[model samples]
Target: MIEEPKSLRIGPDVGRRPSVEQVAAFQGVPTGFVVDAMFGVGAMCVDISPLDTSNVQVAGPALTAENRPSDILATLGCLRYLKAGDVLIGSAQGWQGCAAAGDRVAGMAKNAGAVAFVTDGPMRDYDGILEVGLPCWCTGLNPGSPFGTGPGQVGTRVMVGGQPVETGDMIVADRDGVVVVPFAKIDDVAARLGAIQDMELELDAEVRKGLVLPDPIAALLDSDKTEVM
Candidate 1:
């Protein structure tokens, strides 16, 4: 493991971000579809989830932070760089025993014009966090506060939930899970997302019409690739 920084390594606010309207169009679309459109391989985070798992979705440009275990100073430092429609993505190292942040920080993010806050660690002040009403995503809940120690990095690529998230990358998250789109790939993926949605809608219409199994499934079921005694 690399030694932690003696002080914060704060970089300039990232300039690249996904098109707002294009990202907003992804609301209510399952993350699985976006992941598939990325060619089944891309910056998809694992394990973390929306704080409100039922009927909540978030999409915005990432503003990343790297936090030490049980410490949030780095996370807090990143707040200075927040912009409207930004999603704060913190690499909490998947620590669950201590809060990644609390309602106070959540409110700060809201005040700073952030669209949401996400981490692979837990957060405290559950009721207050809800009251603040900023969309939050994490592994779970923890009541203990994290230390405000030095040795953190901000505004850089950080690994959270097993994926690399660079500042200004697009983040689309819903009940299914969070997906990160590299800054360079946003337009390319957005270009394909519509076709995926169209296909899914067609399949959905077929299911509603009582058509059982689409052509792909039917073909697979009858193909020589399958055999049974």
Candidate 2:
């Protein structure tokens, strides 16, 4: 008796992607604020960072891929779903020994108009990939090739960098790091960005004047039920 092969589950493309203009507005905003104070949650990837420190920033709707360990067929299949403002994010189960992509795939993804590529797994062709000029964020680089075997999914919710992501989620990435904003929260976050930046700038100006820690910190430390130990 022969074992039946596992079937690949490809979800349909989401009908709605967050506004490209609105998402792109987050390009200059620090991921620190977006993740720490704005979103008020951990939507940032803990292990993912840009492969090249080229002062590049990327913001776009997500095109998600879930690849089986050591296999990237679903990633290849996801190419058709790419648009001018899409970021291809792959969940490779956090595998670090095999590359999820390389120069060839990165070039193809760029040609398809993808703004960036991200993966929980490593990627190959670091120098060549940077030369292609597509922004990439990943755990690291590995030279091992992935199998083309089936049994992966595309355009579906997947886990990457310890965060759950869905297709069309707004992904804002820069030198600081990648921050994911759910589609439902994109507008809300965008609306709050201005006020947050305003306050941050005001506070920065005060600090630059050699101002010491403000009354809030003193009050908190002085009170605290008066416990000094």
Candidate 3:
């Protein structure tokens, strides 16, 4: 007979992490810019939004946890894995029946050195979380509580906000949404960011000067490619 599964399974810590300089490069950068750097991908679903808009905007390597529906054992376990500047990504498999985290959890995450908490499921203890002052992003709020029962995993790959997230992946979030940069693509994305920022800045300047249409769109409208009926 097969042995019963463990109540909790904590995977090995991430073997690789983005360099400090690389991580710093993403600090203060908007989620939109990160998406552009990745060629219009990497953004999480829009439904996961900041709990406190004023406290939005954070970038850090992820410490992932996977929990079952109406449970938070994995999230609680993941806290010990947090490093300074880490972002705790708690996955409830998009379940919203109960809270995935709350004020006490947020306080624990902060004490563990996590910069932010992101969850695909809803959360509770809104006022307490705000008082704890830990940045958080979630689908919404629920007053219901969750169980601590296990069959959960920590420091493992998880799907959150409809995106596959790994422990070492870089997570960037703001008022717009969360974005995940795969660990393998961190350097490549960072290399491309400068050019993207330059282009965006140039366009912003042109828009300030009362430019009506973008050059590409204008060219398309003028070309034979356009047929007016």
- Show the lowest summed lDDT stretch of 10 residues, model 3: 10-19
Q: After superposition, how far is residue 135 of candidate 1 from its true place, in Å?
A: 0.7
Expressed as tens digits, the lDDT of each residue in 93-130 for candidate 2 is 88887999999999999999899998999999988997
Residue 4 CA displacement from its true place in model 3, Å: 1.9
Candidate 3 achieves a global lDDT of 0.91
Q: Candidate 3 lDDT, tens digit per residue, 89-135?
A: 99999999999999999999999999999999999999999999999
lDDT (tens digit, per residue) of candidate 1 on 1-229: 9875577888665555666676676666677788888987653455687887668877888999888888898889878888888999877888888999999999999999998999999988989999999989898898998999857888888888778999878888888788888888877888888899898889889889999778887898899987877
Question: Once model 3 is optimally superposed onto the true structure by TM-score, how far is the C-alpha of residue 203 displaced, in angstroms?
Answer: 0.7
Q: Give the TM-score of candidate 2.
A: 0.92
Please tell me which model should have the higher lDDT, number 1 or number 3: 3
- Lowest summed lDDT window (length 10), candidate 1: 11-20
Pairs in steric clash, model 1: none
TM-score of each: 0.91, 0.92, 0.97
> What does the lDDT come to for candidate 1?
0.83
Alpha-carbon lDDT, every model: 0.83, 0.83, 0.91
